[model samples]
Target: MAINILLTDTSSPLGIGLRNKFESTTFRFVAEHPAELSWRDESQVREYLAEVKPHLVLNTIGWGEGTAIKPDLLADGAECLGRCLAGSSASVLHLSSYRIFHGEGKVSHTEADVPKAASDLSKAFAQAESAILGALPSSLVLRSSWVLSTEGGSLLARLLADFEAGRSTVISEHWRGTPVMVSDVVRAVYAVTQQIIYGANNWGVMHFGSSDVCSESVFAHKIQDMVQAETGRLLQLEAIETETDNSAVLEVRRLRDCFGLQPRSWRQGLRPAVRRWLDRRGLLAEVDSAVVEND
Candidate 1:
């Protein structure tokens, strides 16, 4: 039997990646775009869930700029989803950001660490996470760091696009994190869903990210190197020195111990992702054109 999966926030990078990967599978992937539905409306959410009858609800919504992450929306929407899912047998999986843990001096935050959200965005995400967990105690929550995708306006894609357009930017060197690929996130979700469907019954919050923790400057340089290696394009990326440290490392022990899945480092995943991005946009040949023009 195909597990009916209802996904909210389909417009997000993670949601889009999930749909691309799992749409053709035995799992029935149904998405609801935020623009198409009023997420804050409790009655509307209830009606939709009743109609979908999803065995698993993957709520990948978040506080992205220019998106629906307003305080009212976050409060009302989370309350609605949590309230609705509480009555149904469907399991909920809420995607969260690692930025929620704003404590200093900690290299990595684990499941045991309490969230100390510093910014408004992190606070909002924390509140939403709490709402879902409070409503559905058996639900799964994931605090993922630096989610990168080959498609869309993700940071990686945007940087590549900028490089293609001959734009040079300064990146801070003090910030550090292990950027997890969107494909890996989707895979992790799939693995957990399988366990949930098969009655594995290990449900709680967990952190997910690549094993390699590097600074933003290092990650930027790595992407530049990968793109150059893949397409012979030399992108200008300057690293600006910073004295203040901004580190976001997540401990993935639970992810490994629980699901038996170990995510690969960004180095292992960058080449194919860059190639795929260049291929999709036909930007692979742009380097050659630039070379010829320069000549």
Candidate 2:
């Protein structure tokens, strides 16, 4: 027979990418717009599982993709998942953010380390992660950082949209982070899910985001440069102080120990994000037509 996998998330770039990455059969995907749908609602999720009977569940649903993370939603969602999947044995891979740590110094975060979250969302994500991990040992927690999808629908989308609209942004000069491409994160999610189910790897929290970590200002400038080169528009970026309360370099020993996977650098992922955004923007039209289309 064929293998069945379910990709769960709200309407984020990475969430959308998951469906696209696993569009072909043998690697069937079950996806829903978690932003509109309540994955926290046990009855709803159970219904989805019943319908899909997925061998593995990749949960990309969270509030922090573009919006500031919400504490209530995080807690409630986990409470719901605990009740809903209390019995089902489907292995789960919960996608998390690099914001879980909020201090200084370059230190690698492992699956065993208790993270100090940087924001409200990260804190709640931490809570939910604890709850889910406690309930399901087979569950895998994927702690990732900044993820770029060049389209104007995700974090990259917001940044690019701001730049295209001639808005100046003040990026944190001190706050640096790893940025994973939507494609890379999705690929890792799928790979970890596969390893857990077929390869029978014991589950735990893992770090599977980009290895390259940089400041928001640097990250923004790179994007600004790319768009400027492509559209001949300069983007203004101001630097601001940023802080981290967690380890700068996190250990991926557990992840490698389990599946021997290493993610791509954020730089490698940028070109694709730009291309996708340009495609979405329909930038290929003749200048006159492009003007007309805008008009």
Candidate 3:
């Protein structure tokens, strides 16, 4: 049976990506943005939940830029959504961030490590997770790191734009994480939802992302190299050191054990991401035409 899913914050990057990813018969999805519920309005969220009465509420809300994470807003919204879903049978699945961790030690953060949210954005993330989990016991809080996709003007798009303008892009040499592809994130979430639908009855926080870890600078260079390989355009990249401890490499053992998923390498996923970016800019056709002309 297809689960009726209510997706909140559909206007955000992740929300939009979720919409694109779930365009199939796997599950029935109804999308709503912040404009509908507004901020910290528990009554609005409660009313919407009553109207929808969905079997699963996929709360992908609080979609902000990677650079700017608003914790207070996120926490309030999570609390509101959690309270709304508390009285219903709808299982809530909330997307969280790895930025909640301090990323202090060299080892990757496991589900066990205590969260040390250094920045206000990360602190908000931590609070939000707690609020939802407390309200909805059957909720699944999946914390992900460096979610990248080809849709919209995401960080990846911004980087490409900078490259196209002949500007040297600066990538942080210190910041590190297992940058997961947003496509993989969608798949992982679906897998977990399937488990829930089938009565697996396991719900709590878990980490999800690719297996490998790399510095932001390294990842940026990989993107540059891949684009060059595809379009023959060399982009100048500048690497710099940073004192910020925003780095987090996820511990994915739970993802492997629970969902039976060993995530694919981010490099393998990058081709499609870059292809999407080029397609969005209409440069994909240009690249194809150039290839044909050269041939």
Candidate 4:
């Protein structure tokens, strides 16, 4: 049977990339953004859920950059949606972040890792996860790292911004990530939802991402060289700090063994991000002007 699913993805910039890469192959999806819902709209949604009896409710709604909005709202809204769909056989896939971890020792965090969220946003999300885990035990929590969109604001955007302005941008040498492409994450999430592997019974928190750990400096150098070789302008990588900590490094062993998920290499993921960013900024033609000498 074609599973009927409703997806909330207000922060979707990867557009058809998401729909094409995953959604089309899986559930019969009814996707909506944040603006599409309301207290009344939720009542309507509940009615629709009761009437349609969807097999799953996938929420990818989040706020990182928009109006001076509170991050707690996203968490709260997600919790509310979870509660509303409670006991409908429509399990949730909460897309949480690795940023929630405190920058402590080299912790290969697991489902049992103590919650040590540092910032307000992270705290809010942590709180939301608590609510979901506490209430709907069937929900799946995916803690992801540096999930860069192939076509959006990410490490690539910030780097491209500096590169285009003729400023010598320095990628923090100390910063490191597994850096899963958003497309890959989306595909994995779709699998989690549609029961290709773990479904409602696959309880507990699980880490997900490609299996490549590279420091931000190394990453920057690779991207800079890729751009320069493709165009001939040099970009620099400087030793610096990344707020990201070891907890976010994620003990992805669970996902690896369970799904046999062979994530693409970060190099494969990054070149496209760089190219996309360069193309979006119209710096593709003037790739030489896109950077300064790295030292």
Compare the candidates by lDDT and give the number of the best one. Answer: 1
Q: Summarize candidate 1's per-residue lDDT along 1-295 as a digit string, tens digits.
A: 7689887876667777777776767788787444557887778878888888988888866533223335556656777799888856778888877767754546778888887777676677788888898888678888788788765645576678778788985677777787877888889988887888888777788889898899878888888887777677787887787666766788888878988879678677777778767766666667654654475
For candidate 4, which ten residues in a row score worst on lDDT? 61-70
> Model 4: per-residue lDDT, tens digit, 191-224?
6665633343676677876676776667677778
Candidate 2 contains a number of clashing pairs equal to 15
Best by TM-score: 3
Enumerate clash totals for all models, in the order shown.
Answer: 0, 15, 0, 1
Stretch of 10 with least lDDT, candidate 2: 242-251
Predictions in order: lDDT? 0.76, 0.67, 0.74, 0.62
**lDDT order of candidates, best first?**
1, 3, 2, 4
Order the numbered candidates by TM-score, best leading.
3, 1, 2, 4
**RMSD, every candidate, angstroms:** 4.0, 4.1, 2.8, 5.2
**Candidate 1, clashing residue pairs?**
none
The better-scoring model by TM-score among 2 and 4 is 2
TM-score of 1: 0.87
lDDT comparing candidate 3 with the true structure:
0.74
For residues 1-295, write the lDDT of model 3, one tens digit per residue: 5678877776567777677766564777787544656747877777767777789878766755564345667788888887777766778888888877864544578877778776577678888888888887788888887787654444575578776677887778777788777777888887887788888777888898777888878888878887777667887888776666456688787767877878767676687678656655655546575764575
Instruction: Please identify which of the two predictions, 2 or 3, would achieve the higher TM-score against the true structure.
Output: 3
Cα displacement (Å) at residue 146, model 1: 0.9
Higher-lDDT candidate of 1 and 2: 1
Question: Would you estimate the TM-scores of all the predictions?
Answer: 0.87, 0.83, 0.89, 0.81
Task: Say which prediction, candidate 2 or candidate 3, comes out ahead on lDDT.
Answer: 3
